[model samples]
Target: MSIQRLIFFVLSALFFIGSSVWIKDEISPKWIKYQKEYYKEQAIKVEKEYSAASSAKEKELLGRRLASLKRPVYEVKQILLKGDYSWDKRLNGDKVDRCITCHIDEEKLKEKHPNAKEFPFDIYGCAVCHGGIGRALNEKIAHKGIYYHKRQMEQRLVAAESLFEFWSELANLTPEESDPNQRLGMGDFKKYSITGDKAIYVGSKKCLKCHTGLTSPHVERWLRIKFKTFELVKEAPDYIAGNEGYRKTCLKCHTTGYDETTGRYSEEGVTCEACHGAGEVFSYFMDIGKALEGQKIAKVGTFGTPYNICGPCHHTRNHEMRLKFFQERGADDEWFFPQHTTPYKTGLTEKGDASKSLPKIY
Candidate 1:
């Protein structure tokens, strides 16, 4: 061969070999080295086939076949800190998420829907309502990193027996003499209570951390309804002043916290886990980008949950439970209507939903 032709051929061969190595490195998952080698072998095989091609058309066909081979492309961001993140450049560079990759439909729905477009997923984040770790990339880490699922969690409650035992250390006090501050169910008993390995959901304490009485009607409304239960239960012949059956029943229809005695959680009012399922199990089975595009998935907490946050309480529990309580006590349901109502789920319920209700994060 001529000197110029030999040099050109050598350079071309080097370029081809270098490109194959680079391509394998870029695409390989790298857990196993052989997978990359397999791809390299396939590349070499194709190159050999191309070399043996007799005509320009055959070479072009081989080139097309090589191009058509399905290869997975992975895009990743090196997260140095919690604030470090990626953005979706295609949709206005608004925000970025692994969730968006799976929830394309929700992304479209949220982007396309008139009501949802204003409040994008990036702004609100999936964790607020869904209760999972938004910062995490994978299914196990993202979900496992969040706070324990309130419904399923066994929190440290001031057990009635434990309370009695402590109080018994002081004296055999009557219900009237019981200090409100020291009472098991009355005060912030969790401060004194010992947390267990198996945590269960205490009332709306988790919810009240953000949705305080100064801002919204959540705590105030709960207090009002809860007190009414006390007043009604006081009328019962078997009722003791400081004990908790009536309050427990009030929680039945009033709040969403789990009642261990009753297998069914009838009317869970608005709370974090009420809308979202337990935090630990949250995962994406498919592309999250589709979900955002308005396509729905069953794995996500919002749609996947067995209970509807509003439906059970609104349609049945709110109207039925309090009425049942009154009827059993020989009082008419009409009197209780003013005191107990079903307006809990009719309007907005979150801190962000209410004006200036959101807590300052700084």
Candidate 2:
């Protein structure tokens, strides 16, 4: 075709597409309204059939069956995964959480183990004990840890700050070349950029709400920093806290904290967040808006932490920093501290079975 004719045809098609009712290839507003009306009719028809139900069980079953009915669109339909569920509860006077909506299994555990007082899904919500953005429904936002994010933000900030401290000629370089570390001050790193489902371990603040020194001594003991003037602290000159390898690899599991000694919070120590990951993501599958069920709970470690999670550190390896550091410092692994191949499973019943719901710290 001639350039002029081809150009004209292309322009004509573009104009038609832009002006069409199906903007962005989605259904038209008129068609959506029609679909809504059709669903409404279906709902009414289902209600009429439900009225003839004989018993409560029958009604319940029928209700559940009807709930699965797919909603139609202009030219398509979809099975709604138990319509926008939200489990909300009052933590204190003002604090509220909708975590139970997705973590319905957590709610069910109360029934599973009637004796366990701690699993009170109402009095104690998920986000309270486990640190996370409570109000966030999105997977990434909800499980973000304040401790990790803060450090990440600080690192980004510090790196950006350092880039400008030592400088070379920038008169003729391009934008990318001018800045080696890329952009400076892109707002808060945690809030704006770092998009991971990191469980913000809430230290012991939430646990302390109900538990006291009498009830939870181990928890309290772990959270504290007691540097006795009499006793000498273990010195690791090579494995300094802020060193490149230590910061990157060692402390990801050695302990949960902003630094080597102190935790994210002053009272923060190795809480549930240490072993069990951020509870919010594991409990609630955001895609389905439902709590993980049965074997899924065990696999995900939603309720209980498995020993396998600690394999990254505990598992034997060659040329590992721990081994090399120990060897160089004339420290014997067996002498200084006996290294276990696997972290012993804690909080188990006498029979070695899972404690159902109760957390009996072994």
Candidate 3:
């Protein structure tokens, strides 16, 4: 090879390596690490103070104060709230305003409420809760709600609880299911869910059943790639396949479930048990078409709990759990799946049709 060709090839190799790291890191859940530390510290400080206080009156007052200052464990500042988000706001309109400026003492809160100890870190900081100029005292600039601000701050503690409940349900288990050693559910609970179908377990076969001839960009892409779950299994084998010859590769795209008849799918693919929770319990409530009849869609669908529905699968925190793990299926890896080419599958429950609710933004 010519000297120029060699240099070009080396540079290309470096670029590929760099790109892989960036994508992996992007999918990894590092941001949560920082936020958890911050919350835990605050929670402990307040709990300690609350426990030590001898005066009941003082404790009551402290508890009230903490309740007012407490923020949600998640960072969703937009989806849950309205009004222009102005981190610059002093107190009014800004989501963060309600607590930091007013809470004279929060340490007493953590001490008083044992539940507070479960939070990831110390009390949420002033700037953390309120979006406005963190230390700014001016009301006019600080209270601005819209410009450059997040729309939701989750003022109600109940909202956080509700969100957690949704997530717990999505994992097909609850707080009881949380084992640090094992991978939980599929996505992140923090970001928005793609494709209105909150539940991805319906299987591509089901999707292809109705959408076989549907020619959309996404369909075209799937067809072009010949992205059949069975074919992928044939290409690269793994433990998910087990002694019976099934593959774990299916879990990469589908949710999980247990099949008593086959006994193999009992823990693989986008089974109903994964997103809708274990049917062993919730199956009674979920019948086809029942979700649409009610004013509030059944809790089993994506809209039932959009955040929790999307969070588990969307946010790829750990490497072993990310989608790329599926892409890296081949034994020698002679062929690699294109990172950007594979589009996520979606259905009716992901994000509701915006057109169904409002006029066009443009």
Local distance difference test values of all predictions, in order: 0.40, 0.40, 0.39
In lDDT terms, which candidate is top? 1
lDDT of 3 by residue, 1-362 (tens): 99999999999999999999878745553444444555666666667788888999989976765564465353322211222345553235533223333232356545543333322113222333233453333344445541232225332212223334444333432133355644344333322111111222334444444346753665667555534433444434333334442333334344254333444443333432344443321221133433222112223345445545555544434223223433333121112223433334323233434223321110
Q: After superposition, how far is residue 86 of candidate 2 from its true place, in Å?
A: 23
lDDT, candidate 2, 1-362, per-residue tens: 99999999999999998878346334343335544665566667777778998899988976875675444333332111111223553223334455443343343545543423522445334442344665554445666763333344334322222212211111111123355534322111111111222334444444345446545775555445321200111233333423664544534444443334333332223454444333333232322343333123213322333334554444545226554554444443332232334322322214332222322111
Candidate 1: segments with Cα more than 4 A from true spot? 1-21, 31-249, 253-317, 322-362
Better of 2 and 3 by TM-score: 2
Runs in model 3 deviating more than 4 A are 1-227, 237-263, 266-291, 294-301, 304-338, 341-362
* Strongest candidate by TM-score: 2
Candidate 3 contains a number of clashing pairs equal to 60
C-alpha RMSD by candidate, in order: 22.8, 23.8, 26.6
lDDT of 1 by residue, 76-168 (tens): 422121222234412232233444333333534454433344224544444432335444455565575343443332231122343223323
Per-candidate TM-score against the hidden true structure: 0.24, 0.29, 0.24
Candidate 2 TM-score, true structure as reference: 0.29
Clashes of each: 42, 1, 60
* Model 1 error, position 24 (Å): 2.8
